[model samples]
Target: MMTVIGGVDADRLLKDRHRAMWALGDYPALAAEVIAGLGPALVDAVGVHPGEHVLDVAAGSGNAAVPAALAGGRVVAADLTPALLEAGRRVAADRGVAVDWQEADAEALPFADGAFDVVMSCVGVMFAPHHATAAAELVRVARPGGRVGLLSWTPGGFIGQMFATMKPYAPPPPPGAQPPPLWGDEDHVRGLLGDAVTDVRVERRTLTVDAFATPEAFRDYFASHYGPTIAVRGAVSGEPERAAALDADLVDLARRADRGPVGGPTVLDWEYLLVTARVAGGSTA
Candidate 1:
């Protein structure tokens, strides 16, 4: 049992408290969908044979970690956020299973080289500020024949289309609004991994995530769960007021979405992607 490295500071706790509150209101249903975002493809990819060591980066609330532990693998779930990790620990306890949960940054993993048989993230690495470094770290901690997998959102799906909607909220996006590198292009993905990746495969999957009944639904969720991070980032870049402005803009968008077809009880859409790749020299690769 490796010692877990996590401590909650006042700011982190406060930020996460807000994040939890936002999660309660924003996309609660969709959060479940994100839990099931990869479906069976990811579990199969992990090849979770009993006793194998696995590391799940950006494990969040233990979505992938749960399955890995249930499969009898000795697993560690690491994430940068403390609140999420605590939530994961509680979840593991509730399920009557044991998993090592750690608060660690993916870019600076604490494990030794080749420490894990498999390394993965459920659409997490794609969102890292230093993604290439993080990908290399995933490959670094994995053994020679180890497998690395990523469950990312595909471009042009319902989720992709939603990003297009987000653009309007930050029109002339707040200062320092840079385009995301992985909006939906294979080339962007290739650039992230470079050549250490011998084989890369992507499978499309459908996820009916109920984001919001209206655009306002979306805004409410984003404002709450994702709000603190966005606000800090925007504020740090001198766009301090962008958060409220964008929140307003997003609410307006949701109002427009209310007029969308199939608008009732909730907003639903099919959006998700299962991406599998290996860090060259794998027995299977």
Candidate 2:
């Protein structure tokens, strides 16, 4: 007895789960708080200003974009998925804030040269066609005098452990799977930035995200929100049934998940990389 979600792949996986891909509620407010705390630390680090034209790339639901606009900057929120762009627009509107929402790919943008005074992306980009191209594109769109910023989850620390904790229940990742290092790791990110960044700094921060009222809640959250990860991954490569089976396996594993409280603060170890590099005309540094 097997069912499938049609043919899905990584892209399809995202497509299927875009709705569930949403960041948790209060995260938007929390994001603003994070920015506030890091804002002073990143003024020079990220070159943000009150009036700078900014683009929040992969700006799912405009959480960061709306706040940036409220801070008095003309902001545009862009993302690959039209669905996400639509969600972002609604969010901006709900907040009574005006923001330009656009559908664009990070690997290649349809904007003009030096289109933004400041370019920033949060929690997105690692899934792009190529991280190098995406990083370079950020530089390409920013004016030489402008700044490029990215906020990414720091890999292999508290956050890493969090993911690690869930790995057993996750669909088997590809072989030799090495996740890209995130912003918290300076040397790694610097290397990723190469010479494009004249200066770089990693501001480390963490927060307590509500884990779940019960393990079942966490399991259901992913089942509904994260999409059937296994099913989607298989469909991505055109093997729905395989993924479907894995999907069941995943849920089954979830039932066996550590039985704990229905509500508790699961401190998510996360890092927001606010590296502000003065755009160097011709490099990926």
Candidate 3:
């Protein structure tokens, strides 16, 4: 049932199910190998400085959180999954940085208004299911004139197409769930954050990925390690033909996107949207 939490409309059941889905796969591996650089990149973009209050929403395994902490900001890494939080703790510990890890729903972040100086997510908050709510929460928690930064996969990017490819085989999305890739669209995000923020700046960036040796290898890796892919595979597990078709489609997507030497390892340039804005009002101390 949908319930208002922290003044935001949130579906408890959907949040619970989402937590479970994210906890299923070996997400730490995926984060460490595929998108480890995003956190630092975002932190830098937001100009995180020593002793600023920073919040990393939907920070799976503390990707951005650890880096923020390392940069000397007082960082809080909040996510829906406890397992991921624990993993993030270990990561921070290993890096010799301290971060406050908490379980938090992106749509209903448990924080006071203007609680942070910099609110950021590295390809994280875009998947909150309710884009407008999540976007509002991001704004609400940032002090006036504070920064809000986000990195999300573009709709035309490899990851976006992969999600699209999985939709045909996966179960119906829960009510109020917006397509995550919409976060990458500049107009969509500006509309979501309308009139609440100022100095909105967007940059289109590309991340080079070459972790897989082949398209088939990329497909197999995602199937085994990515939560969304694993969930889709499970949805079609009862039908071998459907599962096989998905496998083929994933390979085709990767192959088509690959821009590597012929007969060489797979190389893909994943496009993403980087957005940074300031909450409209007086500066925070």
Q: Lowest summed lDDT over 10 consecutive residues: which window, candidate 2? A: 225-234
Better of 1 and 2 by TM-score: 1
Model 3 stretches astray by more than 4 angstroms? 1-10
Q: Give lDDT tens digits, candidate 2, residues 189-224.
A: 677778776756556665334455543454445544
Task: Give the lDDT of residue 84 in candidate 2.
Answer: 63
Prediction 3 TM-score vs. true: 0.96
lDDT of 3: 0.92
Model 1 stretches astray by more than 4 angstroms: 1-30, 33-35, 39-41, 155-184, 227-245, 251-263
Ranking of candidates on TM-score, top first: 3, 1, 2
Per-residue accuracy of model 1 over 1-285 as CA lDDT, tens digit each: 222236535434433443443334323233454445452357677577788898998777777887788888798998776667777888789878799999777767999988988888875555555456677898899887777777766656544554554554432532222243262356666676677776677666665545455666655565555533345334435555665665665566445434345645354454555656666775763
lDDT of every predicted structure (CA atoms): 0.63, 0.58, 0.92
Best by TM-score: 3
Report the number of clashing residue pairs per model: 3, 11, 0
lDDT (C-alpha) at residue 166 in model 2? 45
Evaluate residue 27 in candidate 2 and report its C-alpha lDDT on the 0 to 100 scale. Answer: 33
Q: 1-285 in candidate 3: lDDT tens per residue?
A: 576768765577778878998998789989999888888889899889999999999999988899999999999999999999999999999999989999999998999999999999998899999898999999999999999999999998888999999999989987679999999999999999999999999999999999999999999999888888999999999999999999999999999999999996999999999999999997744
For each candidate in turn, the TM-score is 0.72, 0.67, 0.96
